[model samples]
Target chain A: MISFQKFRIYINKCFIALICLFSFVVLLPFLMLIARLVKSGLKYICLDFFTQTSPSPVDAMLANLAGEAIPGGILNGICGSLYMLTIALVLTVPLGILTGIYLYENRGKKFANLIQYLNAVCYGMPSIIIGIVVYVSVVKSFHSYSVLAGGIALSISMLPKIIRTTRETLKLLPAYLKESGLALGGSYTGVILKIIMPAAKGGLLTGILISVSRALGETVPLIVTALGCSMINWNINAPASSMTLLIWDFFNTPNMVSMVWATSAFLFSIIICLNLIAKRIGRQWKFILYHE
Target chain B: MNKNHILELKSVSISYSPGSYALKNISVSIKPNAITSIIGASGSGKSALLRSINRMHELYPNIRMQGEILLGGKNIMEMNPVEVRRRIGLVFQQPNPFPTMNIYQNVLSGYKLNKIYLSKSEKDRIVEECLRNVSLWDEVKNGLNKNPLSLTVGQQQRLCIARTLALQPEFLLMDEPTSTVDMFCTNRIEELIYRLKNNHTILIVTHNLAQASRISDYALYLEKGELIEYDKSNIIFVAPNDKRTEKYITEQVE
Candidate 1:
């Protein structure tokens, strides 16, 4: 009995210590990276860092930019990112939600299975490959690089992820939620739009935010299709640049390297803001889960 | 053949697939203004029978049902499934008040979905009366804008009942509606079932024999998907004609 107890204790210790060791090992790199990045990345961050663009190779200390800082702000890059995320979100959210609904509502159909297979394939397809497809289809058709082109490409990558996440979330919802909606005389469209949408709002928003952030960082697809531009441009019909391309651009220009750090800082701030907004929305959506 | 029969099932049988029948050949009548209870063990097709009244079986493409279920003398299977569903409201065992909507919006969900336009004040009156009928008005009156999820489990179940009541259905089908709820909510639902008997026909599927006895005028005892005995609640409870019913009651008592 004593040996049995010792054996059991040994097993318990092995399991608990194994988990702790694995987690610590996994966290080590992240801890080192954040520490290094913050220590090095903080020096290049300041008011001018955000305000000024690189007018010259030598004047990239951010003071020059702060000196010129005005309404322009990160205005152009901000506009580009917003336009990209908005277009991607607008197009992808509806299509993603509908695709999810189709997958669940008609899971038995051959067409549904085919679509699901396509969705899975697209999900695993590298972002660069998607960009290649979109480049040939959208940008090549238009014969120019535009925010619209980048959005179209990014949406391809975003669509499958958003759809899969949303469908999985909706699947987690109690089956009775949909049945209750139907029982209350809701139509097919009504059950999805009013009932499922509300119940899955938090998860849906999380999916969108994750997709948006993922799309925001997407460099390879944007590089081939939309490339990058310097000036502030709005009309999606016009050529534009985004933060990811900007990051890639600065990294190659060793003299313009500090601008990359500043940009990283800026991207981090926006993502933090996005996560905060998502959390607030998540709190709002806890209502649906509570009643479930 | 009764003209007043709100819903009738004639030799209705529902099958899971070709060879497997969930509900065997059964025929029953539901009155327009009375409480009818279906009491059976789990998987006895009691819920299946209730679902068939509204043709909700169509939601499951694999399941096939035979025979005819007439809703107000009209064959529901022949009618538009959507239309049939609208007129026959149902509540399930779980409290499923729409999580996205507030109490008022939950109540108005039926009308909103069907695109039945109602004025603001008129909507208020309907909401008030429905909540009051379910004994949830005073508790929720002040928090009309509060999300339905904020309510306790009992309140949420009551909210679902209110959502069903708002449709003004001719018949309401509740499938084990109280099985998942606490006794306080169960009592409230039972009382609502009794009260609703004066306005609309109600069908309930329950495992609680005492509950079925208290609120139901008639009881149908089903076993292994077969309707074995259906009679006045007192007769079914006290002097069950079928051996299965007797066995079930005795087992519950023990």
Candidate 2:
């Protein structure tokens, strides 16, 4: 039997080895999926892939060696997604941040306490539930699944994230900052806007970016609400389809599996680009915060 | 020293919660342009006493108080907290210049508090003049737009002093302003305090008796939340009226 002291050392070593294995296990699925996607999607990338969107398996994909004309462009899906996402962001970011600030700044007030509890509950709720609520409340009234309904649902789901992140980011700010502003005769709003927000700008930006990313990737709400048409609708007043629905619809199709892979790759790349951009912007924001 | 008694506290007593006396009934008159030092051991209510002048005591919760803190012949309790604070500038022990602001912005914080529309030139002039008063003009002149934290501790403390001065307050409350600074900063701030004494009524809280003797015109000793003694700084150092003051001086001297 090993002595306790030696056993402790052995345990430490085993812990480190376990961490390595766990990391690999965690990464395995993603790596495998990405690797498979890259390999499968390589043959699909071409001038036709760029110019044409909905390629029939019998046309562009099946007649791989034989050149054939493809119909449609992801242009509609792109436009619809861009349009709805913009509306969702416009609806969510400002309202979410303002609510977050209210919760944090007015902390300990009965209203603030209520808001805190509600925000917490909202954050924990499943996005699907929000989607269904939006569907029943807004979509049903319109008597059809619409992009506006989808966007409203997306905005609702994004709201809790934005509020949670904004609240946490505001909390991360130094307590002395508000005190300093207060000491200087600054009003409560002035202190939050001019001092606290500026100090926590980096963290707040990161939080907002996370919320945006979460909104961008959401599909369940869009599926149940927008029901996702293939055509691009510029006006948020009208029905719209987005990339997530395209990915979902294509992946399920027996004949259109190739197009699904391409769209999947596109969406995955977009998310990565977004994350990188957010990371880069966050770093810059922090630099400005500390050294402005 | 300036002859006007700019601020006064009459029988000011504060408690953190119910029946927890942080400061006992303490009466003191702050003279204009004179550096008055509040000296005591830690938890002796020196900081609390200083905070009461600018209504900083209300910054916490469940803390109750009874006091008539007068500013320039008016009880500040009758005025708005913002109004009282605007008239009395405070410098903390630590050099806490706003990190998000540039050197120039920190000096103009007081004006920004009013949210008054100021011409860019007027704002710039205030920043330059205030920084100049604290003798931080040259070191930070080339970098007015640069962040405040990039400056040395000595420069930061001076910047804080400059920040305080920008409010155009008649009195200044410094809570151990030199304790966190180095000797160079200490000397620099002491000199600045000396220069400031001709204009603003200054109340400083510190455990450093020598510092009290060095910069303060009036020295006050407090113990167990009670006023032990008050006299001219030199007299307090050489021939203190209280045995406790004498013991404090002896301990510091050793």
Candidate 3:
């Protein structure tokens, strides 16, 4: 007969094996997706893939017939993405942080709780719905599918997440820090600006980066709002083309299918890099805030 | 009578909710340049009484304070709370030295918070003087640029004390400032508190009865928000006039 200790050890080992198998199953799809993207997309990522504006469908079809590479890059898409992203960030970050601060300071108040509830509802909303709403409001009012409309849609989508992150980060901080600053005869604004904001700087930065990546990944919203320009457009009020929009456009054209994979690969790399940086900042800040 | 007391509370009652009082009609006088310890069981309003002096309770909503607190012959309630807080500094139970700040910056945080700009030389002098007063200057003098969180908790608490002292407040209110530190650190902090008595009036809420007996010139014992006993520490510890105070003192010692 086996002893109880041996039985327990056997059971623990079996449990560990089971957990490892399940975790591997959970990660399999993501690993396969990355592998597929890298395999199909790596060869297309050349210098012109970045420097030149995306080729017209006819140009791409002729290049394929002649056994030549695509003539142009997703330059217009890159420029448009950057332009809309800047506007979205400018609109989202400050407003979200301020709203979060108000919620934190007015904790347990009826009005604050109502706002929190509404923010939760907004956070749970579908991105496509937000895109359509912006189309009806901003796009229709301006009579143009412009970068501004696309930016407004993306900002709306990003706001709730940023506010949640800011409030949660502030909440993780010890209450004593605030009291100590106030005790030093610091006014509320002074303490928040000078003390609390500095301490929470790391978490706040991580929040911004993660939100920017999320905004970058949003495709459906931009399709309905920005309406996809064929050329590089600098005006905020003009039609714009984003990376996701270009990917969508490439997928619809038969000869430009390879361009879709390359764009996906670029977007994936950026998002992954951003998430890794955010994770690093989160860890380093936790160590500094809690550990010696 | 008013001339003898540096700070006076006249029937000051605090209630968290509408009807019930957390601190009930507390009337007491604090002598100048002395260390007074507030002692009681948990939830007996020792903290509420200590916080009332600095108006710290106002930070939370739905808490009401009735009655007046007199500081230097003027009503503190009538003063701007910011001004009142400047005159009365607070130290918390935990040693929080502003995680983002270095030792030098932590010491001068009060000035920075108030936006009171100081020349580099003047700022350096204040940091050195405050650190020296806390007996931490020699140890941390070389690492003034180091983060305060890198120090032991005892050193962090001292840095907090130094930060409060940098403001030169009239009274220092400590809410069990040494509770989180070890015995040796507690002794060091007690000694510092005793030394600080020459410059500022202090009101500390302590769970340690022995610590109160050892350092306090005056002791106030409370039970369920009522001030049960107030006298010289020698009297309160040795020959208390109230049975509850005696019971609390005996119970805590065991």
Candidate 4:
């Protein structure tokens, strides 16, 4: 009976090892794809890759046929992404933070619970579904897919993340801080804005950074709203391009494979850089404000 | 409504629910320029009674308080809570100086919160005076920019006192201010409270009978939400009063 128990333990160990191996195997292809993309993507990157607009698909195809490389860069896509993200952040951050504070302050109230439930549902909703909704509401109403519509879509997706993070961060602060503030003759709004919010600044900033990174990489929403342009377009009411959209547009074509890889590498680097910078600043901010 | 009384509580009771009372029908008058200590065992409503002075009990949604608390002959319930708190400050059991603020900022936090603007020199003077009153000025004067958390527990408690004093409050309510600190720190804080009573009416809630004997001019002994004795501190300590107060002081029924 003891020997049988030993065999059962040994079998369990083997199953665990097999599961680990299976997970690694599933992850291996993604690792290799990233490696290959980095290698080919670095070869195509140049100063003009950020400074010049992407060529038309036909122009790019003709250039490839003539034994020339793709003639233009992804400046329009980069600019468009930045524009939409800025608009989205402007639209979403204040509203999200205020809602978060409201939820925290009015925690046990029915209205707060309702807002929390709605936020959870919004957070769990698929990116494509948000895209389709935005397409119908904004794109159709405007009679054209525009960057403004794209921004509205990204803002909706980013709001729940910012709101949740802000609420959680504020809640994690000790109750004594608020009590002390109130005891010092501060109005409720004054205490929240001055003491509680300042204490949670690092967490709020980190949340915004994560939200921005997520918005930057989103493609599905833009596809239905902005509808991808090759030329640089600054008008919010006109079609625009973003890095993700460019990658999506190029990846399926036979000759634009290198462009897709290059764009992917660029986008990945930006997102990683943003996250790292945010973490570093957050640490520094806490050290400056709260270090003992 | 005696002129000497800085604060008066008349038949005040606090209940968190319909049927249970945390503090039951307690009435007391606090004299100005003196330290009055509320002494009781744990769960005896000392803290609840102290909180009612500044209306701190109102912050909790579940708490229900009845009757009147008057500050200087005016009913505090009719006044704005924020304004009432400005005149009657509170110090909690724990030494909670704002972790995000430096010592200088923490001291001036009251003024900043109340929007009582001062020129830079006036601000410096208030900080110095308040810190000196707490006897923490010499230790912390050089490190005004340091985080409040960098200070020892004793210094942190003193810093909180200074923060309260910076607002020029008429009455200071302390709920077990020395309960979390060392014996030495407690002695220092007790001394500061003794000195502060010359300018401010101070109400302290303490579990330590010895501390109440050491610092308080008047003693208010409570038992099971009832005011069992209110007398001069020396009398309350040395003489017999209510059997419960005597029993608690003797540690026979603690």
Model 3 spans with C-alpha error above 4 angstroms: A1-15, B1-5
The TM-score between candidate 3 and the true structure equals 0.95
lDDT of 3 at B30: 86
TM-score of each: 0.88, 0.91, 0.95, 0.94
Worst 10 residues of 1 chain B by lDDT: B1-10
Q: Could you tell which candidate, 2 or 4, scores higher by DockQ?
A: 4
Error of 1 at B46 (Å): 1.3
Of the candidates shown, which would achieve the greatest TM-score relative to the real structure?
Answer: 3
lDDT tens readout by residue for model 2, A1-292 = 4698899999999999999999999999999998887877555555645454454444545444454333444656666677777778889989998998888877899999998899889987888899899989988888877778887888898888888888887776667787778778787778878888778777777877777777778888888888866555665556677778777776665566666777677777778777887788778766665554
Per lDDT, the best of the predicted structures is 3
Estimate how well candidate 3 is docked, as a DockQ score.
Answer: 0.77
Give the per-residue Cα lDDT of candidate 3 at B3.
Answer: 58
Model 3, B124-196: lDDT tens per residue?
9999999999999999999999988899999999999999999998899999999999999898999999999
lDDT tens per residue, model 2, B41-78: 89989998888778887878767879787776678888
Task: Provide the lDDT at A2 for model 1.
Answer: 100
Question: Each prediction's interface RMSD?
Answer: 1.8, 1.9, 0.9, 1.9
- Model 2: CAPRI class: medium
Please give the CA lDDT of all the candidate structures: 0.81, 0.81, 0.92, 0.89
Write one digit per residue (lDDT tens) for candidate 4, span A72-173. 899999999998998899999999999999999899999999999999999988999999999999999999999999999999999999999899878767
Task: Give me the displacement of residue B210 in model 3, in angstroms.
Answer: 2.5
User: Between the candidate structures 2 and 3, which one is better when assessed by lDDT?
Assistant: 3
Point out the higher-scoring one by lDDT: 3 or 4. Answer: 3
The per-residue C-alpha lDDT of model 2 at residue A283 equals: 82
